[model samples]
Target: MASQVDHRYIERLFRAYYSGEVAEKIFHSAPEPEKREWAFLRLDGPMVRHVKLTSIDDLHSQLDPPPKGIYYSLSTYEYPDYPMPDKQRIKTDVAFDLDADHIRGAVLQEVSRCKSCGWIGEGDVCRECGGEVRKIQLVDDRTIKSISGEVSRLLDRLANYLDVDIDRLRIFFSGLRGYHIHLEEEPYRSLDSVERIELKDFLTLDGVEIHHAKEPDSAIIRILEECRDVLSEVEDVSVRQVLESLVNSKDNPRHFTSIRKRLGEDRVLRERVSRTVRELCGVNIDPVVVTDMSRLIRAPYSLHGKSSLIKTPLDMEALEALDPPVIALASPSNNMVKVHVDYVPHLIWGGREIPSIHDEDVILPEPLAIYLVNMGLAQGLRHV
Candidate 1:
C-alpha cells in the first residue's frame, strides 16, 4: 500500500553497476541469450515487458531508468523469435539457487503485524490481538554461514563426483540471501526438462535411504554418511544420549517402528534427530530453478534491488565466513547515509553491535542503511 522502495536510488544503482560491464567476457561468450530472447526489466513501478535487445550496446542503451530486477531466459532456441514456448529447441544451463532466507535459523527473529488491528508482534501471529499476519523483513547471519557451506559441498560434488569440470562452473553470490551455481558446459547445457529434474533430485538427496549410503562415493552416499557422522558425533548431551539409546537398542534402528517407538515417547529426542538429519543431509537448492528449463535467474554480477548487494563471484574462503552486509559494504568508496532508527533486533555489522535506538541520526554504510529502510525497520533521513 505504501512505497518503501526508492525508485530513483535503483535507477542510479543500475547505471553505476552495469555501465562498464557491457563488454565483459560473460556478456560476450553467452551472447546468444541476450541477442535472441526477451529480457525482463523492473522499472519504477511494474516490470515493463517485451523489452528486447540485440547487443551489449543495446543493453546499456535501453536501461535508461535502471531496472530493480534484470533477468534473462534460460531457453536457447533456433529461430528464437518464435512466440511459442514449444518452439525453443534447446534449453541451456542447469542453475542452482541456494538462498539463505530459506534456512530457518537464518531468520533469527521475525516481525509480523496484525491485519485487523495493526498490532505489531515479535513472531508470525498477532499475539495480543489474534489477527491475520503480515511479515516484515529481518536479518540472519547464521543462514548465510549455513547456506554457504552447502554451496561449497555442492561445488565439490559437481567437480569430483559428477565429473563436471571446474572450468565450466560459474559460482556467484545471489546478490543477497544465497549463491547461484550455473552449469553451462556441453552435454549438461542441452539436457531436457526430465533430465534437469533428475539433476535436482540428485543434489537435494530426494528419496535418500541408508542403502544408498554405500561407498564408490556418490553425492547421495556422501550426504547420508555426513548425516550419520553428525548424528554419531553429536555433542549435545540429550541428543547424544538419545542416539546412544537408538544405537544400543536390540531392534534395528533403520526400521520406522523401532525408531518411532524407541524415541517417540520423548518429543525432544525425536526433534533433535530430525533437526540433525535436516542440517547435514542434502544441498539446499531451490528445486524449481533446476527442474524448469524455462526459469529465469538473477543475472550474475547483477545488483539485487532489495539488498543492494552485487551477485559477484564467490570464492570458497570468502564464502565460508561471508557476512552479506559487510561484504556488500566493502567497495571502492564508503556508501554513507544517515538513518532515523525506529527499532530492530540486535544488528551486528562491521564488528560493531548496533542497538535499537529511536529518532537519532545514526551514520550507516549505504548497503545497511538501504537494507534497514527497505525492511521497514528504519527510515532514511533526507539531507542529513
Candidate 2:
C-alpha cells in the first residue's frame, strides 16, 4: 500500500518547487510497486525539435557500458497561471530507447540538425556553416564505453540502503555516456509535479543526494548555479539567447529549451549556444543514479565529495572491510561469478553500468555498505 499524502505535504512541495527548490532526488525511495513511479531526469537534456528518433539499439560494453540517460514523463496538470487543468505534470509511462523516442517524438517535432558537428539544433545554421563546432567520437558498433565497472557495485549499495526492491529496478544503457534506471514502484506513481520535483530534489545530483547534504541546499547550489553554465537548452527559448549568453553574456542562467515551442529564436541562437555547451562544459557531466530510476549528468567537482561509487584504490576483500560489491561465483572456480546488485542500480563498471549480466562483476577497491542480490530478490517485491 502507498503512504497517505496530505494537503500539507503537497503545499510544502509546491512551495519548494515555486521557490526553485529543485527536487532532483525522487529516485531514492526503495518503495515496492511505487518504485516504477520513481525515476530521474538527465541534466544533459536532449536537443530535439521534430523527431526522426534514433534507433533504440541500447549499448552495453565491458570497460565502459555507456552512461544512463535521465528519464522524465510528460504529465498533465492545472496551473494557477493557466486555466487548463492538463499540463506537464511530471508523471508518465517509463519507457526505453526506441520506445521513449517514439513516445517523445509524438510530443516533439524535429527541425534543424548540425550536419557538421552532429549538433541537434532547432532552426539554425549547421556546425559546418560556422566551422566552429568541436570534434566528437563517431557513434558506431564499437561504441564508446564509459561505465560498466566498479560503478555498478556503488549503485547496489545505495539501493540496498534505500531499500528499493531489486526486481522493480530496471537498468538501461542510455545512448549517451551513461545508464538509466527505471523504478516501477508507488507513492512514486501518485506524485504530481511538485511532489515529483521534491523527490527529484531529494536524490542524486551531478552524483550526490540532496537529502544527504551536509550543508543545507548545497546540492541545489551545485545543480542550479555551478552547473548552469552547461546544462540543457530551454524547452522554450532560442539558440541566439544561448549564444548571446555564452559568448556575449558573463553568467549562464538556468532555463529549459522546450522541445515543442520556440523555433526562430532558437535557430538564430543555436550556434553560440552549441559552442559554449561543448567547449566550456568540458565533460562537465558525472552520471548520478537515483533510486534506480534516472541518471543525472552533473559537474563532477560539485559531487566528488558525495559520490558513493567506492574509490578505486582498494581490492574486493579490502573493499569488503567497508561496503562491498555483492559477488556470486558461477562455479567453485570463482573465475566466473555474479556480483549481487540488489540495492544500487547505477553500477558503473568502467564509469558506466553493465546492461547485461553476461559480463563479469566489477567491484570497487574501497567499498561502502554495498549490498548484493540473493537469488530472486524480486519474488516478494511489490509493484507500484
Candidate 3:
C-alpha cells in the first residue's frame, strides 16, 4: 500500500540500528488479556517508532526431520520496516527447539536409519528402496531464503488456484531447513508416518498412487475440506500475490524491479471479492511441502508430548540476575515501540507456558541479544 517496503528504506533501517551501540530489549503490556499484551519485537540493535505494525511467528517446517541434518532456518522473515545488518542478520537466526541442542548449526546424522524413509540403513544401501544411503542436511543459512520463498509461493498458488483463504493456510518455519504448510483442520492429527511421506511424495513429485480405499478422490478431497473457511477471507488478491512473491524469493524484499511489477497489476474489485466469499468453503487435500534439506536436528531427543502439552518455566528472579538487563534502541521505527518476546513451546493446542510465563521475562536471551547487537553494529546498521 505504501512505498515503505523498498530496499533503500530497508537498508537505511538496518544500517542505522546495526551501526549503533547495542541497546537493551524492552517489553510492554498487551491491551487486555485477549485484548492486548506487551511483547518485544527484538531488532538487530534497538529502535522502535514510526512503524505501522509488526508480526513475528514460527518458521514453516517439514512434518518430520531429515537425517544427520539439523534445521538452522526454522524461522526467518523480512520486515522492510526493520532489516538487519549482515552481521546481526546472521546472529538473529532463531531455530525452533524440537530437542535439547544448539539452536544454530544443528546437524542430523544417519545412525542406522533412512532419513527419508526410516528404513534402517545397516549397510551401504537401504533394504526398502536400495537408494544409496547418505544423510541429507535438513536446515542451514544457505537454504533459509530458498525454502521460505518456496513455501510462500506454494501457499500463494494454492490459495489462488483453489480460491482458498490465505489465513486458513497456516505456514510454519521448521527451525532448520524448510517450512511446513499445515491446513488448519482437525484431520491433520490423524495422518500417520506413512501418510505424511505420501504427502511429500505428492507435492515434490506428481502422479502418486495412494490406495483407492482411502477415497476415490482423497487427495483432491483433502485440500477442499481443510481450506473451505478460508475462501471467505480472500479479500485481497494482491496480498496473495505479494505473499507468493515473498515465499518464492531466495532473499528478502526480493528484486526492486519485481516491486514495480506489482504496481502494474490489476486489482480485484470489492463487489467480485464479496461474491467469491459467499460461494466457496473447503479444502480437498491439505497441501504441505518440506523443502529438501540435509537434516532436522543435529542431536535429536524425544519429548514426552507435543509442544502444546509441555510447559517449562524459568525463574524471573534468576533471569534478571543475569549481568546486563538494559534495553537498547536498535531501529528508528522501534525506538518507541514496546513489545515482548515469549519463550513458550508449541503444544497439542496453542502454545502453552511452563510455569515460566509468570516466573520472569527476557525480551531476548543474553546470547541472542548480544548476537543481534554485535552483528548489527558490524554490518554498519547500528548507530550509537
Per-model tally of clashing residue pairs: 0, 86, 111
Query: How many Å off is the CA of 159 in candidate 1?
Result: 2.8
Task: Output the lDDT of residue 120, model 2.
Answer: 34
| Ranked by TM-score, top first | 1, 2, 3
Candidate topping lDDT:
1
Candidate 3: stretches off by over 4 Å:
1-148, 156-166, 172-182, 206-369, 372-384
Q: All models: lDDT? A: 0.60, 0.27, 0.27
Tens digits of per-residue lDDT, candidate 1, 1-384, equal: 214444455456557766665335335535365534545456555754334456666666655556666666566666455554544556577788887655533444456667787665466678877778887756445435556667777787677667798666777767667678878777888887778877777767554432223232434434545456566666778766554444343244354345446555666665665565545566778888888766667665566776666667765556666654434433213567677665565655444566655446788766666666677656643434
The numbered model that scores best in TM-score is 1
Q: Candidate 2, 66: how far from true, in Å?
A: 27
In model 1, the runs with Cα more than 4 Å from the true position are 1-5, 16-26, 29-38, 49-52, 84-87, 104-109, 114-133, 140-142, 209-222, 232-280, 321-326, 329-333, 350-353, 358-360, 381-384
The residue-level lDDT of candidate 1 at 119 comes to 64
lDDT of 2 by residue, 277-358 (tens): 3332222222122222222222110111111121122233322332222111100012212233222222333222433221
